[model samples]
Target chain A: MSTDSPIDATRPIALRAVRGFHVGGRPVDLVDLPHRQLATVPGLQPRVSNPNGRYQVGQLYVQQFALAAPTARYPLLMWHGGGMTGATWECTPDGRPGWHDYFMRKGYDTFVSDAVERGRASWAPACLVSEMPEHRTLEQAWDIFRFGPPEGYGAANGKRQAFQGQRFPVHALDQLAKQFVARWTSTGGMALDAYVELIRRVGPCTILAHSEGGRLAQHAALSVPELVKGLILVEPAGAPSTAVEDASRLRGIPHCVLWGDYIPQNSLWTIYRRQVDEWLAAVQHAGAEVTEFDLPAKGIRGNSHLPMMDDNNWLIANLIHEWISGAMEGGMSG
Target chain B: MSTDSPIDATRPIALRAVRGFHVGGRPVDLVDLPHRQLATVPGLQPRVSNPNGRYQVGQLYVQQFALAAPTARYPLLMWHGGGMTGATWECTPDGRPGWHDYFMRKGYDTFVSDAVERGRASWAPACLVSEMPEHRTLEQAWDIFRFGPPEGYGAANGKRQAFQGQRFPVHALDQLAKQFVARWTSTGGMALDAYVELIRRVGPCTILAHSEGGRLAQHAALSVPELVKGLILVEPAGAPSTAVEDASRLRGIPHCVLWGDYIPQNSLWTIYRRQVDEWLAAVQHAGAEVTEFDLPAKGIRGNSHLPMMDDNNWLIANLIHEWISGAMEGGMSG
Candidate 1:
């Protein structure tokens, strides 16, 4: 179902639609395309997307678009937290203006992508494990490149570790670690030397993450240091933990944190403390400025986890704009 | 099935248990208990009710327990915000020691209740016309003095009001004004002196509200000033169209303003000009001291309408205790 390194023809056609740039504000069609494609609904307005250049790279499929004026040199790729698809960025629950416009007007071309391990991936986990032949469960989701499906769960044999209700036999972290290792192994495990090469190829960008996607952002940052300049995370689920120590060592890259007052702590909350501690230490280690934010309380449909979708989310919009301005401007002084 | 006044005797008994200072440190039994309804799963721990007393007069059905000191005036009420019934206060979502024990040791008696309103009489709407007496449609829940169902809904021939989402065929104010007229007519069209006499019987107490309930609280204040003393609303919602002029002209009582941020034109995000022209003027007219609180943003949930339920909700708890503690402390300095 998947071919490594072979380009998909759809990438160019999508790219053309995005490049057209509706100066007159022509109606752009973001029709919920197949396999996690976004579409424009009647009551819903389209926020942002790049049909072109937005292509699938191996297992990971990404949608990228260039933002309008006041553009930043580094691109911004926004991701949905876990249990949420990229569509979360496209429409309000009741079908209204997506936050995509907020970033675009501010001049950051945004990209929302799917994590390669689940959901719309064409290859099933069963099939995916076949290639590298060592993956199992949500944990093995990370190991396609380095080890086979962790011990017992792997085709004939891969170790299994399941905690909570996770169907995966391995620890989520263990799987993630092995997956990164697999990716490294596939590329000859050159570590930073090759990671820097990929970073340069992917170009410069900052990550805007929510919920579980925050964890992915942390991993991406740790794996590829030079590619990232800053991180704008909103109530990211799993963060900083021990990973924060690694993330902080990346040197002067700024980290902005926005957490909700009533937000329930999960792995994310744990990460918040870890990341902040790591950051404080990281700054001490690297001698960089650290910025942190705590969002005031508000209920979105009586639920407190999803902040961007809060009925009274205008505060966040202002804060985002301010944070971006501070970040873009602060870079000069730093 | 319900009657007016506090029917504590006939109602079932309810107990609130915490992890540290439980009944012999054993779990609580919450069956057929007089006001102690388990809105959540039985095995789950009980949390404190709102300290700010927002979100459905949440404090009304509290289960009070003795503190370690046995002689504390202001007992701490553990409140969990939306979604969570009240278990959130005892332990973090992942189950760890929360604020209850921390405060109990500090010599504060603790109380616990649920913010959920489906079963509470306090949440019943103030003014809806309906044939059937459902929970809070519009009609006063009961003739409180009579301790029986009111004449309108109880009567088989009662006229019903239409429910059109947030819209209504009748304006609440106009309806209230008409009720004033009808109530007057039914009472032989009494004069202003008689009206004042009737309202005085309504008695004294303060109301605190959050989110949508805030609008209702304001309406209650505007309509029945005799029944309220210094309204303490936490982000109440109301239309400026009807409330502005009246609120501005109002006099005597204090209004406390607590909001995170303000964006132009949003009903939630009123401009300063509007605030001065409308709300602040009303507060001045009422002659109330206005205390503005901009709480810390971190760990804040989507429940902004409910500042009293934050993890650090003691912020407002202390504020409330300040007001409540007044007469008890120095016998009215004013």
Candidate 2:
């Protein structure tokens, strides 16, 4: 549609109202230390813990984009993947207006949230100490996600080659690379629990989950189905197992599984797809309406693991808008 | 490097000089019909074949972008893939300046050409009669290239899903879909032969070939090594075989094989990579300065098969420029 010039028109127009807030934080006891006494000691350099060490855990950071006249029955909530923040939906790595604003423009109140200990949800020392986490380097992402040539970087060799039709903006790769934060192995459960709580407070709504956020979405939907009306899963890292009881509880609720290009070659993604398929099958058998969206089948190409942050993200957003509108038109409780 | 704003700065500046011309065309006799008799007939108006019909089997079309003070010692000849015109190197599908302009800006005389029976090289009836060809549908590309979800299009399903990280410009997808020309199975050999001839005429240049264009580049390099100073292969469809004789002839020749992302998942590309590896092995054994660029290895991600028309095409062009300059600095003979 943008033939004369290539520009990102995905940014949402200024909404009637926008707000930011914190959700689901629990208070912690203060830690008292001999700060003055330690400082008085001559030779040894004194270190003191903050006198107000009282902190919050399981709290999340959320930014809401509200439309004055909502078109949909329920607000759309966006949950980010692991080691990421609410920023995932705020603006694209390429600096385009992200899904948060796009969905807002579509007349749906949009809520973007960062999970416990990620992004704006500052983590407590207890949560961080549970397991040592590692930061993912840009090189690791390049290879794992099949972004470009698999080798050659460092002073000896310059930047490696990117894949031929990758949708992620390689020009802004450095900016995107900075978004990969340290992730912990034990944080999934905590994040999911917090997300479920957030859903309860927000009331019934449609949820869009990506990667690790899939777990939270699934858990919340199952644990409190009353709060969730629909599910849009974009390459979820894991899916609800057949072992999940009362799959029928999700009956009548619309669920769509979205897959991008290059899934077969990615072992991890293949496994994830298998799990998702199995889960979707179980849900279907349980009488829930399950739809599978294979991007390649629809004539869309060259998408990576992070479709929301991709260059063609607007197209994906359009697709989501249509699906969401259709689902909500039937009534949010359907 | 562009962090403040994400803009495609790949567009080329107005060149100091530019020109276009046709190569490898020959005279053909025009068919003459009995004008009076043909006009008398209603439905079957005229049908006559010239007794002296002379046709050119393999001619091509070329456009050259020249710089007054070229930095590189040799010119860069760009050969497009199957069913594609020289436009592949002219501008990106996302509206960025393509490799043709990018390399020209780097101070090299760049030549982009259409192969026999492709684009500007209109084919004769004889070529068409050689074999039946099939036009690639958007559906086929969506699946084969791993562009989008592998299912859902047409009336049955209104829209399809895009892959997560695909880099192809989805907004311009319909426009790009129109670019998929019908490809004949039997035309490969003809195109390769014509390309080799073109190389001989051009003399001492660097060839940048993509996908199907790789075959022509390899054939030309092997048949007439003297004309080729350096080789830059960008995701060539096929690689050389072990059967190559006198492999040492390419010894000391600077050859760089650049691969984009998302190859492992695509079967055809996987096979292509294997073959390319075999050829690279042989080339190395023969002592050529062979450089393999695995984009993912270098931390570049989300590339599709058509890097030249991708969003980061300028980056790929920049890489080619560096390699060419380095190769030329050591002497074009290498």
Candidate 3:
């Protein structure tokens, strides 16, 4: 593995536009609330206010970075996982360019998103939401993100351990932790709706999703199969059950799933991997093109759940880009 | 007035980098807690999770877009007002180019920030925070943002009215509301600390801040007066009292304050405007160059609290840009 950063930080890139917008939420009306004072500043008197009228809730935020000239036929919509935002695709914790920059450099216009109720996609009031938001602790992130074994995160600095050959920058776990956000279990449907709305708005486009976002992308593709040109699932937490979903609908949408180094070691991932494998088999049975990359099997070692943030993230991005080119061409030929 | 959007949205720009990072937060240790299951999917079994460990809290997120060619000597830091993120400077709700796009095209490197506990800057647990978070209702926003009189936002579309000749796209008020996020009363100090840390990291810079953000920029300027080349405050909510802040320290920094229409009609802004006026007066008294633009007085009318998002936002941006050039030259000569 190379110790040097893959990206040159000072290099300039030509861009058509860097813009952002909100999509897919309806107004919810709040009526007849008693007047109250809300304290915004500690020393100042609380302002008397009314909590009434129409408020827009459940909208997703998308920030687009368009290359001057795109080689790919379709734009790429980058969706982040749970407890994370569009920042997942922006830059790695260790300051290297992540998938967004990598793919943009590869001549793809990228739309990175903050799903509904996450990041810049503001949340509704607690009463309107189905459940309270939950936060991810570092211990939980270490165990679940597969940085190391369940007990690898110890009390002291010296006690913390990464899985042998862990490609993730374990020392930068705190930096990754900074991107953790409070997510609600109830907003999955809202997020899926917003993502589908995004696909409709952008017309024909490919979706590259991570973890929780993968399932949302899967559903969005199924919802609007004609608009979704390709689906890239990176370490997805779960996939739609083959028995439940009509796999024939996804026949035109090429699918690619990428797995990192350690799956058998983690009990949770073991279950998730099995579920996805079954789902992919069902999709393939229905005559859809499906590609799977198990990193270790492919001789790419020591990768974590967040391969895009790994030391060899650029390499992984290149692999995905190559796969995308082949898949798009195959779709055209078929 | 021309109905055409002020910005040419299709233009391309050269950028050295479009990157994002987190700054200024300390790790908080979570003590012993019983293991529990977290429900992330509606139909699936909840996953067992550990809630004990170190968590990073109170950090701020900043995204930077650097121009390719040298022009401005210092970068511009854009801080959003309450209930908004860096998205405030990204694009107008009506799909017009925002301050970020305009300023970047004007040959300035721009760093737009999400303040602590807002937007990409995730909030701490309720237990860790001083007070519960609050959401702004459409009625509250209408009253405070001064789109019209307190009674302007009627329940029916036909009944609603914008103060005669309001420039804010009233039909798109819902669009603006989409950018609103839940904010905390207790996180002001944390936000200030993070803003100061950003100043230290970015070196000498001018700050362009809106509403509540204006106060934070003011304090950050006072904390590191030498690093803050200038301050552009748009409808600032509050300012440091002359009796408490040593205005002499601000003598070297040029200050610009801009106000929109209908302040007298909105009681709250009248008080806020007065405080900022006194603060600016005191700074000018202490020998700082101070410039104030009451838009109506300058023949720029029909603007609301968020002048940067108004229909004529580009015109206002150009005004600010010209002022910046003059201030920078004056600083050099003086």
Using TM-score as the measure, the top candidate is 3
RMSD of each: 26.0, 27.4, 2.5
DockQ of 1: 0.01
**Model 3 lDDT, residue A8, Cα:** 57
Candidate 2 lDDT tens digits, A27-145: 55444432221121112243232323323456665656555467778888898876555556755656565666566556677787767766445455432245444434455566455
TM-score for each candidate, following the candidate numbering: 0.32, 0.46, 0.96
Candidate 3, residues A13-72: lDDT per residue as tens digits? 778888888999999987766666677753457886566666788799999888887878
Relative to the unseen true structure, what is the C-alpha lDDT of residue B87 in candidate 2, on a scale of 0 to 100? 52
TM-score of predicted structure 3, chain A? 0.94
The per-residue C-alpha lDDT of model 1 at residue A14 equals 12
lDDT of 1 at B5: 16
lDDT of 2 at A57: 56
Off by over 4 Å in 3: A1-11, A32-35, A155-159, A330-334, B1-10, B32-35, B155-159, B330-334
Which 10 consecutive positions of candidate 3 chain A have the poorest summed lDDT? A1-10
Rank by TM-score (best first):
3, 2, 1
lDDT of 3 by residue, B123-205 (tens): 87666765557788777788889988766787466666889889888778888999999898667888999999999999999
Error of 1 at B155 (Å): 88
- For all the predictions, what are the DockQ values? 0.01, 0.01, 0.69
